[model samples]
Target: MNNMIELKNIIKIYNSKKKIKVLNRLSFSFKAGKIYSLVGPSGSGKSTLLNLLSLIDIPTSGNLRISNRNIDFNSKSDNDKIRAKKIGIIYQDNNLLPDFTAMENVYLARLSIEENKKKAMEDAKKLINNLGLSNRSNHLSSELSGGEMQRVSIARALINSPDIILADEPTGSLDTTNAKEVFKILLRLKNKNRLIIFATHNRYFANMADCKIELNSGKIKRATNARIK
Candidate 1:
């Protein structure tokens, strides 16, 4: 299987007044065309692990490679380029620019990769329609509902045609009905060959993934067989 992301003996630490270890010699390889859910309680280092995988945070020690290329933590410019081209991140809060319209938010992702404004807008519209946000494309972030904003966030993440989507509790704010709808959109997107990995405490939602792994005390427990489809 072709791997999209790899982590080798990764370690991350935090220090304020005292040193705190977040990740301890962690290693994992994520393959393309698979959806994996990271399950654990809050403060279990799920978000930290996702941040490390997404290249938003550097490990204190260990190796990280995306699409088989080593990521140099010292190279900020190259890391930004790799992130813009290959990784998409979604946050639980949706993190929409309250000032920008839904379409603008989605289009911005494409703009980060290409400078063609016309083409970017066109592509963003297509994604909005596909994600069922075409009607609200002109609406500001404040005007959309929780689920709608989340869909917009997903559309933005996917508009760049990224190879990997890292979602941090993507549906944590939604009700049961909206949560299911959001997952449906994610499942559809995952079918297009992008690796989907998310951190979530909801076991019901985690069961929908092809693979499930638990994190505790900065270590990944064995992945067990879960609902696969």
Candidate 2:
């Protein structure tokens, strides 16, 4: 598989009361066709790293390349286009608009790529039905249960058929049963053209990944099944 994401000497610092280094010379290359579980303690810069991968944030210093194109962080419009076409992000909160129906929430993402409303709705319904949410398609997000809401979130994430999936604590809010079910759906999403990375504290979920990446004191520490350089 080709390298989907590449980082060189990546460093991130946050300044408020003082200068805090979150990622110190973190360098890693993530390839396509793999599921990587990001495991780290709280405040270990897991979200910071995800933000970089998703093109939502830039590093203080270093290089980032995605999908074979070198990223120019200063080009906000170009980066936004890359994110819309290549990256799919899943948040812990499911981030759905409360007033929109589940179908609307999913189809809205499709508009970022195309202007055809009818085609977007058809594609959205197919994705939702595939996710076992057809019955809840018309239900308002506020009326859906936590698990159902998360499923809708997944459908939205897949709407663009993104090449990279960045999930931040994807199942953190659900009970064990729901978390497991949701994760199963997430794992089933992997394909040769996609690179899936999810951050989680759950050891069980972490172990299921093809590779385990532990962030310790702002560095990428590889554990079991990791063959990346």
- Deviation in angstroms for 59 in model 2? 0.8
Model 2 agreement with the true structure over 1-229: per-residue lDDT tens digits: 3999999999999987999999999998888999999999999999999999898988999999897789999999999988988888999999999999999999999898889999999999999999999999999999999999999999999999999999999999999999999999999999998999999999889888889999989998765674333
Q: Pairs clashing in candidate 1?
A: none
Native-referenced Cα lDDT, model 2: 0.93
Error in Å for residue 98 of model 1 = 0.4
Question: Per-residue CA lDDT of candidate 1, range 85-162, in tens?
Answer: 888899999999999999999998888879999999999899999988889999998899999999999989988889
Which stretches in model 2 have alpha-carbon errors above 4 Å?
226-229
Clash totals in order: 0, 0
Minimum summed lDDT over a 10-residue window in model 2 is located at: 220-229
